[model samples]
Each structure stands twice: as C-alpha cells, then as structure tokens.
Target: GAALAERVAAAGGVIGRDDLAAPTAEWAEPVRQDGIWVTPAPTRGPALLAALAGERVLVGGPTGEGTSVVAAADGEGNAVVMVHSNSHPQFGSGLVAEPYDLVLSNRAGRGFHPDPGHPDGPAPGRRPPTTLHAWALDTRGTGRPDLFGATPGGEQQVPWNAQVLGDLMTTGPDDLGAILTRPRWSLQDGARVPVEASASAVRPAHVLLRVTGTGLTAAADPRIGAVALGV
Candidate 1:
C-alpha cells in the first residue's frame, strides 16, 4: 500500500518495512445508477468516465495479462460478469500469508493517489481508486441482471468496457460477435488515441452475455482466438 511508499518517502528513499504491517480489507457494496451498477468510487473508472462524458472532453489512459474477465447466464434469466485482477503481475502486494499464501489486493498501491488528503489517497484500510470495473444492466425492470459484460485491458478497461456496453444498449445482443471483434481504439496516456491493428491486436478478449426471450446469448472476442462454447 501507499504507507510503504510514504514511509520510504519520509525516509528519503530508503527501502525497508521496519514496523509497517500488511494492509487489510473488508466487504463493500457496488454503486448503482439508473439500471446499471458499477464497482464503486474507490474503483473510480466509471465515475471518471462519467465526468469526462459529461464535459465531452478528450483524454486517455495497463497490461491485461494479470487480469481476466468472465460472464455467465443461467436458465433463470440471471446473468453476471466479473473482472478479476491482481493489481499487478506476480500475485501483487507480495504479501502472501505464511501457510495458506493468501495474497492481499494491491489496489491501494497502484490505485491510490500520493496526496494524503485526496479522496483516493492512501489510508489504513482505505480502498483506493482502481481501474477495474464492469457494467451490469437490467433493462426490463426485473430487478435481476438481464445483460452483463466486461473486458480486460488494464488502463484501457474503462473505455473498452464502456464502449461495449454502449454498443450493447444501442444495438442489442445480436451483434455481439461483430461488436467485440471489430477494430478497436484506446486513448493512451490521455494524449493519443491509437487504433489496434486489424485482426492482429494481441491483447484481445471480451465477453457479453444477454438474456432474451429465446435464451441466453454469449459472444467472445476473437482477436486472441477466443471462441463461444457451451459448458
């Protein structure tokens, strides 16, 4: 967490954990708006995007190797999407428990601001601003998830996921395959918007699943050789 970095900064760039202990975490609720739910403020991608969209401003944005996303739907019209990440490569935080090797999330380390007073700043047990997020939508007023999806692209996660959700809402589920497999662009570093190579972008994969009157439809990005299969 930032405490280690803070201590090091206070010590004028020394490396040691003399008295600091590993960070801790607890359960929290998701943030919901309209019919969509997000991963909450500390994971500020959704909100940040909203701010940008509100002003219609231009700006940008990780590697997705340490992250993965999955979506599922059942017979009861229930659907879910999950985006999991280690915050960084190699199990993150590197704070594995002695026996079980339970790894703690490094969201505070990579997601937190350095300033003490910033909303996303580091504090003991404070959840930092993470880019990891997804969108869940229930368009039918069923109070249950009717459509869910997410993508893995680290800093690009927000734009990627947001674009897919936008397309989903606008075009519905029939075009899932084309929507994800189409050439995509990401605003990198808030300076340049670069489009991925057609049929060659390697960091590829996204899942969109929607429940319709007939059944559940799922689409998988094919740029990285992803395929739709029954399980």
Candidate 2:
C-alpha cells in the first residue's frame, strides 16, 4: 500500500488517510447521510436464496464522490470522453487519489467489507474496483455523440446519469444547463436520497457535457469547479 501511494503521488494524485488495522466486524454496513442510523448486519439470507431461485434483487448503496470525469469534442464529428475517481474517499484503504493507471491499495474495499461469496469481495493486494464510467450516445452508425456526460459520485454515477439521459432524450436536448440543474437523485437497494443543491449532494461531483453541432458551445454544472474550453 505504501509503495502504491508513492507512485500515485508521483503521478499527481492525492492520497488521503490509510488504515492498516484489522476490521472491527465481520460484514460492512451501509453508510447513510447525517441524521440516519442503521445497524450493520450480514446480507439477508432469503434475499440470496430468492436471487439463486431466479428472482431479481437490488443491492449496493451510496458511496463517496471520489471520481472525476472529463469530455471533449471538435468539429468534423470527433469526440473524446474520460471518467475517473479514487473510489471511496474516506474508507477502505482510505486513499483518495486519481492515479494515471489503476490503484493498488488496501482501501479498495471502499468501506465495503469483504464477502467471500461476492465477486467484488476484498482480497489481498488487489486493485480497488470502481463503477466510474463515461458515456456517449451514438446516433445510429454515426460516430458523433448525440449526448455525452460523466459524474463523480461512486454508486450515484449511473443512477444520476440515467436521470440526466432520460430528461435529455425527453425534454431538454439543447437546454444543457436546465437539464443538469434539475433535482437529482441517488438510490441503492431501495435507500433513496433526493439530492438537491446542497453541500453533500451537490458539492463533490457534477455532470460535464459537450453537444455536437451546438456551435462550439459547452456547459458544466455550476455546482462544480469544472470548466469547458474551445480549441
């Protein structure tokens, strides 16, 4: 973990806390926002059984906003997009960084304890996994992007982006500002937080977009410090 931290720092990434101690409990619990409290318990048994019996079960929960994403486009139907993050900012190996390559820290757990049965379960000296991603929609066979965007929140990345995509397709194809500024939501396994323009929900991450044939115009969520430039 220490060697990985040195490499990440050399590559211009930020390293936060590091915990080398043993885990306190057998299973990790879901972390909620302030004023919320719940017990840490093993994943329910029937839920697993039902899933094995071909029943769909929703899993996962909210996570820290340790990822960053960027996109760029030029005339002539060319575009490029990138999404990145440090996984859990405050837990797991407690290393908040965006290294050029992948991570090699014990903090890969991202606060979720190892479940021997799960695929993403924690193991020794494994690269911390992440859901960080970038998206660009293609119109038929055309390579140009009809819409492209990225978000930083861990588990909220997909859910939040889904909302943005739905709205962009339905209401605000050209209104990028209006689309991103609208209320956003984050949900995992039925736990929901109607994220609004506040510190926790709005501060850490936001959408950045570039639309083709929009006359060199670009927009970024004001809630974040990202900027858009024209070449």
Candidate 3:
C-alpha cells in the first residue's frame, strides 16, 4: 500500500492518491488467504465523490495509524512515558539497503506474519495488532489523576480515546478548556461516518485531551490544527 501512502503523507493527513501512482491491478490485489499485497485505500475528493453519489454510499480510506505520544505527571505521583514507531512507513516488504542501511523511515513498525486460524492472526513471534493506545484515569485509584489522553488516529485511536474521556468525565473540572474545545465523534469500519467541520452534527473520531491541574492544561483538535497549551 505504498507504505500506507507514505504514512498518510507524513502525518499531515489526507491520502487522495498520487503518491506516484502506478498500481492498477484493481488497486493491487493478491490477498489469497495471506499472500499479502493489499492496497485499496484512497478517496475523498472529486468534490467529495460528487456529493457522495447523491445517495446510497459507503466510503473508507485514509488509514495510516502512525504515532507519537507523551504523558507525564511527577512530584512523586508517577507517570512518564514515550511511544514511537507505529503504522507509519513500517518497513515490512519495503526495500532497505545501501551502506548498511541508514536509520529513520518508518523505523520498524509493521511486521508480523503467521496467520494460522486468524485470531488477530499471525503467530510464531506475534506482535502485530498494535494501535498504540495511551490512557490515564486514576480518579478512584487515589493517584488523583482523572482524565488523561492520547491520539494519532489509527483505528481512530480507541474511539478517539473514548470520546475524549467521555467529555472529560461528564464535563467536570470547570470547562477544562471547554471540554477540549468540544465537538467530536468517531466510529468507522463500516457504514461510513465522518464529522469534524468543527463538529456540530455528524460524528465519528478525533481526540487529544488533558485534565490534570496546576500546570498541564491542554486541548487539541481544532479541526486538525489541534493546539492547546497552558503552563
């Protein structure tokens, strides 16, 4: 899949095709149980497909699942982390060579093959099936943290990190940046659903919230600009 369309054009999102355009075998076939070839994700143009074919329609494409996350909480509480390498260029069947192979470039993300009876398939050394989810909610655990978050959009990052932690746990802690700048929803894999023009009606997925205190206020998803920093 051209490394999932160059990791969704290097994470700036939007994969309307033409990464160099060359695959024309009906969108690269050959899945014969597991011969692996896969490719068929590209759309959302042509005037939104002529206004979604004026009726009955279903669409899907744009799945790169790349990642990069950071969550920390100190002063003796504990919670520091780093997560990288995900559904990006994931050098699996891609080429890699020349002077001992220099690093950087999908850095080693996608790799796993052993499907025996499919149960997340692949075995023998199993490790493929990672959406790289991050979460935090020690509300009752006593750690005091209530709603932490993470997102990069791959499998829509766990329903957009559980719908922004259920709207910051039912909109508490005073606005918390207006419940992460409001308007959000996501659920895809069928029946098509997309909403985020500052989301007011339709709904599906997109998130990045933080509800701690003292010095970590955050909110991201300004229809993609995603920004919010308060120190």
Candidate 4:
C-alpha cells in the first residue's frame, strides 16, 4: 500500500502516504452537564443537549456542518463514542490538513458567530461551535453507561439522540430497534431552548446507532450503508 501510495503520488494522484500511525493529540478537557459528559466548546453539542435538558445555556446560531460518528462498547461496561466533522457544504476550507489530509473545517469563519460578545464567538486558535457531538445514557442506575450513540445530522444530532434515548429509557431496551427504525424528527435550527414550535420540522435523518446489550448490537438507518460497518 505504501509503494502504491507513493506511485499514486508520483503519478499526480490524490492518494498520499498511507498513515497507519496511532492518532496522537493533546487531550482537550471535557465538561460535565446534567450528569452527561460533553465535548466542550467551541463545539456547541454540550450546550445544545443541556438546553434540551432544561439548562440555561447559550448556544449560538446554527451553520452548515458535516461529520462522521462512531461508537463501540464492551461486555465489561466500557464504551466510547466519537464524532468528527468538517465545516459544511462538503469539503470544509478546501484545504488538506497535515498527517490526516483532512479537509480542515472552516468552523471559525462559518460556524462561529461574528459578534465577539456571543459565547460562541470566534477568535484565533479558538474552535467554532459545531453540531458534531455524541450522547450517552445510563438508565439502569448503574455506575456505567449502558446506552450511547451519535449521529451526523448537522443540528439534528442532539435532537435525534435525545428523542431516541428518551424512548429507550421509558419503554425499555426491548423496543430499541423499533424505536430507532421509527421515523425521527429534528428540531428547527436545533433550538438552543427548544419549544413546541421547534418540533414543527420533522424528517428521518439517516443515522447509525451502536447499542451494547449482551454484547454489541448495532442498529442503523436502513436508508444508508451496512449496519455492520456503522456507516
């Protein structure tokens, strides 16, 4: 693959060096809100979910966004959910970042509010608020989380996760597949403080969900890729 990638690069192809190296980065601190762990600002996911959970938080306006969400769990009650995104409207910034060759997100310019007074205001070295976020739930009163998942529906990420989680907790895990397969709704702009009117807009935002029961049980939107791959 390395030789092929070198040949491709030499031939003016887009494929660069295949980097199988371990991903390394300075750990960003996490914040807790209403007992849920959130990827802190300038990603607005935590604030959005908190607002939905009836917290007084400030989450600036929405903007175009894109992302990929992945989650996995083990029998020992360990789980992880990850979400990655570019700014919006396809390849963000149109600039390939180093190492990963990622299309750097134009988050600061596009997602952050222009006004400096805003909580989500952008500045040098500051990331803009993003809709990319993962959510988890522990309904069994155990110290570990039994249910968790994420999605890439722009502002719809939180709403979908919240709705599904509510059902999963209320109706029990037996109906989980049915709850996920059922048509879901997304709030308008993913309102910072959702109201009755915000529920006006509704649609099936194709999202993959990973649930850990006896082992790992994955439920994905039928309108999308294979569930086994969690695409």
Model 2 sits at a Cα RMSD from the real structure of 11.8
Per-prediction TM-score, please?
A: 0.71, 0.58, 0.27, 0.66
Please give the RMSD to the true structure for each candidate, in Å: 5.8, 11.8, 17.9, 7.2
Query: Quick one: RMSD of model 4?
Result: 7.2
The regions of model 3 sitting more than 4 angstroms off are 1-68, 76-86, 92-103, 106-148, 169-186, 189-231
Ranking by lDDT: 1, 4, 2, 3
Assess each prediction's global lDDT (C-alpha) against the native: 0.63, 0.52, 0.42, 0.56
Best by lDDT: 1
Of the candidates shown, which would achieve the greatest TM-score relative to the real structure? 1
In model 3, where is the ten-residue run with the lowest total lDDT? Answer: 30-39
* Tens-place lDDT digits, model 4, residues 122-206: 5555656666666655556664455666666666666666776667656876545677676555455434433323443323333
> Using TM-score as the measure, what is the rank order of every candidate, best first?
1, 4, 2, 3
Position 61, candidate 2: lDDT: 35
lDDT of 2 by residue, 75-152 (tens): 764655566444454333443444444445333445344675566565554433445545554322344455556666
**Which model, 2 or 4, shows the larger TM-score?**
4
User: Going through the candidates in order, what is the number of backbone clashes in each?
Assistant: 1, 4, 5, 0
- Tell me the spans in candidate 2 whose CA falls farther than 4 Å from its real position: 1-62, 90-107, 111-113, 122-129, 139-144, 188-191, 197-204, 211-215
lDDT string for model 3 (1-231, tens) is 455555555656444356336434443221111111111122112212222224323322224534555555454344443444434544322443334452334322233324467544545434344544444444333445454555555444444545555555556545656655566555544432444532223222233333444444444555545454433
Candidate 4 lDDT (Cα, 0 to 1): 0.56
Mark the regions of model 4 whose C-alpha exceeds 4 Å error after superposition: 1-36, 55-65, 74-77, 97-101, 189-213, 223-226, 229-231
Clash number for candidate 2 = 4
Error (Å) of candidate 1 at residue 76 is 2.0
lDDT of 3: 0.42
